[model samples]
Target: MSEITNFKGEAVTAKPENAADLEVEALIRSVGDRVRKARDLKGMPRRVVSELSGVSPRYLAQLEAGEGNISIGLLLRVAIALDLRIEWLVGGEDPWSSDVLRVADLFRSAPAGTREKVLELLSPEPPEAMRARRICLIGLRGAGKSTLGAMAGAKMGVPFVELNREIEDHSGMPVNEVMALYGQEGYRRLESQAVERVIAMHDTMILAVAGGIVADPDTYNLLLSRFHTIWVKASPDEHMSRVRAQGDTRPMAGNPEAMEQLKVILRSREALYERAHAQLDTSGRAPEESLERLLALIEDKGFLT
Candidate 1:
């Protein structure tokens, strides 16, 4: 108190030294909230995630509420317990990560009229859109549907799946044996089941359907509703030639009038086949040529841009 001198200078104020520590605490709380939200979005209950990730439920809850300091190992375990990716816990801005935004960006940057054309290419028929777009190729046994479908699928970047082969796989028998054992009705039932399975499993594919599929109204309607049906058509003579070229003598087997029968079959199915969205004349044309025409029609109809 002697002289009451300002010994070192004016008194300095004590600043809030724990501000950064408080902010870190707040960040941990936010992280916990985000983790809970992600868990809810995945429709997973805490118990199931805990069992799957081998994390203790009590510890997980504590981590979620940010009531306890979680170690890095515990954080990872908690993230795994919640079936969450660690990157999601640590947030960042990525507007392009959304599917809708990405698609929008693609369309916006496209050349004039290109996006519309592409939409048309990918547009499904009203019925096809509602169910599954199962593009089934129906024709006489030798119309090159399988061959042309393979080529078309390669171009379209979709899997080329044969319905008959799938039936064989399911029945564990050769197609002819299955048909013989099941009769027409039995074969049809198997075919319908196979078609349903394929439609349920896949969203986009090229289906080489059995020729008899069109004969069954229910199956035919199902196909019409689900696929951009394209009939690969050819004259009876052409069909015979193509089949013979593939070394399949079954069409000509046991019937001297096989060609005539083929003509009749084609005549009966012409109207039915005409119901397709598009048709490609396979008569005299190479598979490549027919595929080009099909592609052109698909593009024109806005199937692919």
Candidate 2:
């Protein structure tokens, strides 16, 4: 370059031969950034990670600063300590990509038959062990959970259960009374119990769940693991319309902000709702059309046990 005045100019002047060195430096910096970013996000102190990873704190600081040379064993130890994937520690910026790499790592370490099994589990197709033999309908109120759930079960020739009803039967109290007496936390405790009981009672069935079930972490976790959850997704307006069509004006009483309130609740829970194994959008579709879609999805996916 014409008289290097900055780092960029100096690199341009010298890097034709040193491109490999530059690439290595960039990789180091990227790894360092990822390590520190993940550590900071977890609110983990450097000393804590160092202790857990069995690496010295000084080395951890150096590693996070792109100045330390690490071995594969140390990298594995660090990954286990941070509950992260080595691929994430080394190169990827995408979390999902790291998850895929972690699966690859698992597959590589597994025994011969176990390798195939691991690959099956990692595939997008549902795994045998965790497959939803018992289907569950999950969504906000007015998303057709009950109607569609019953129809799907009927079509599939299996029993259908409403989890809220199960909760009442188990507790010997109305759901509203349970909520009023004990609050949301109390209701959720009962919900988890009901889910467990249902799983025990019937191995193959369809279950319609309460709209707010996803709000409880424990119960939601149960739903995720035990049931092949299908989210009955609909726009907030569509939800309110369905509710109103069912002649329920309670949600729309004198409050002018009823729709906004519904929207807020839907927005808050959308991410949680999305965790379901599959989603069926009922925004513009009629009940019959939506039921057909849901049934087709269940049939295509073979979620039936």
Candidate 3:
């Protein structure tokens, strides 16, 4: 019998029965390496990837350790969450050596302004023209995006939409129920679909999206290219107070370090939020006052024009 090295580099008799097993084992290790490399290259923590992909941290750990054989369905979810093509994860070729992937990598690492320039160069329409008169408000949950967006829409004589509500309507269930049933990966897919539906239905409207929408690069980039975006911001204290004012104490119900966690989130997402075309600070201000400023901002920015 011919001796061959198995996946673990141990010498073994090369039998036809185990040859297939060796190939499968090699494929598993290759997938695990690619997944780990992709995650590291994106600078995403395992927990963050798990949260976005709806995979458990322990499972991700095992996969990266080259021990867990993930399902195709779950692997596809991870690919989408990473904004990567599924083929990139499973293909036999080295993705890093591909010119297409190299360009994509460069684009992802480019500055926001540079990315916009590249988009303008590549797109058939100018960014503003693609956006038309549509506006999107993005920020933390308690940042008054919804309240101010609706008020602005009403006063400006345009349609207003809450993306979560859109997701709920499409799924025939509430947002929380959708999350409970479908997990983060499913919810994100629905969210992306909702954005597409809104864009197709309305060329001119005001839309408010959830805070975590920015976490998905593909969806967020689609938003940036299709709408005039604003970041509605408030202090951590204001964010907490506003949520509590709405009688939702989930942020502090059991988490004593909630405020600290909130701050950390804000700090982490600041760069992403800053990608918005404009910003409105609503901290220490009444909703009406903030709405007034938001309307003024829209006018000043000529967003509707």
Candidate 4:
């Protein structure tokens, strides 16, 4: 728990002198933080939430600010009004994960089937089906996009472009340098610009995209509209093994929970990844075999002249 100022300006918690009490206080504050996030994400203002929850705006503010010792009944009412699970407020599950955020806003207002139909209607159809001139590959980092994209480009008589390399070239530095100089947000800003440039410059090419491009809905949707998207999927173990085989040990060097974090990210992103025109599972297969699968998917989708 955070300490509040006393009369003499000294900081103190309310009777939290024991370890268990401190833990309880911390949990209360954490729950408050989560409540605030859910409420904000649901587009519920304090006054509206208070009216719906029958808890005064002042109390709601205090609770959201982590200062109110709110009752369980009141908290439950708040949760219901916000359309959020109590377990999320209590931090059992991450409500802000991509998995939750992707659906939470929609699910709060509509059913799952309705949401799917809405998305299908909103998404634009590619002109060439899977034989689009702007062919793009998407997947986890260690997927065989680069290998297969190059080979596919060779067979199809078109150039292959790596979006990351394009990003680096556009930024006038390496991608790592861009991240270091401008941070992830800046890097992502540049990434969107680079995607546009790539689309404009290449009339017919195979594009290899960043693994986490799904995290950016705008760029990913742009790719979907303009390109024949193929998701090259591999098992979690294979993803880890492939990255490791490339001599990059940073994922596990200082973090023991790397694999679990990867699993969480994959779980959060799998649905978004499935939005691609086709999926190729590359587990236990050579790059050449994976390329064959990718070619088959493209051919089956009605490649044109």
Reference-based TM-score of each model: 0.57, 0.58, 0.62, 0.57
lDDT of each: 0.70, 0.76, 0.86, 0.78
Candidate 4: lDDT over CA atoms? 0.78
Which lDDT value does model 3 have at 174? 99
Candidate no. 3 TM-score: 0.62
lDDT of 1 by residue, 1-305 (tens): 01111223223332334878666566667676776766776677778767755556765575577554556555655565553445456555332247744675676567635754665577755543644444667787788889988988899897889999988876678889987998888899878777766775678788899787898766776677667788888888888988888898988888899988888888888898888877777888887888898778766765432
Model 2 spans > 4 angstroms off: 1-127
* Best-performing candidate as measured by lDDT: 3
TM-score, cand. 2 vs. native: 0.58
lDDT of 2 by residue, 74-188 (tens): 7666775666667667764555466765765675556655654554666675554554488889999999999898887787788999988887865568999999998988788
| Model 3: per-residue Cα lDDT at residue 190 | 89
**C-alpha lDDT (0 to 100) for residue 99 of candidate 1:** 79
Please report the candidate that would top TM-score against the real structure. 3
Show where candidate 3 strays beyond 4 Å: 1-122
Q: What's the CA error at residue 36 for candidate 4, in Å?
A: 48
Worst 10 residues of 2 by lDDT: 1-10
lDDT of 1 at 271: 90
Listing every candidate in turn, what is its Cα RMSD in Å to the true structure after a full C-alpha superposition? 18.2, 19.8, 13.2, 18.7
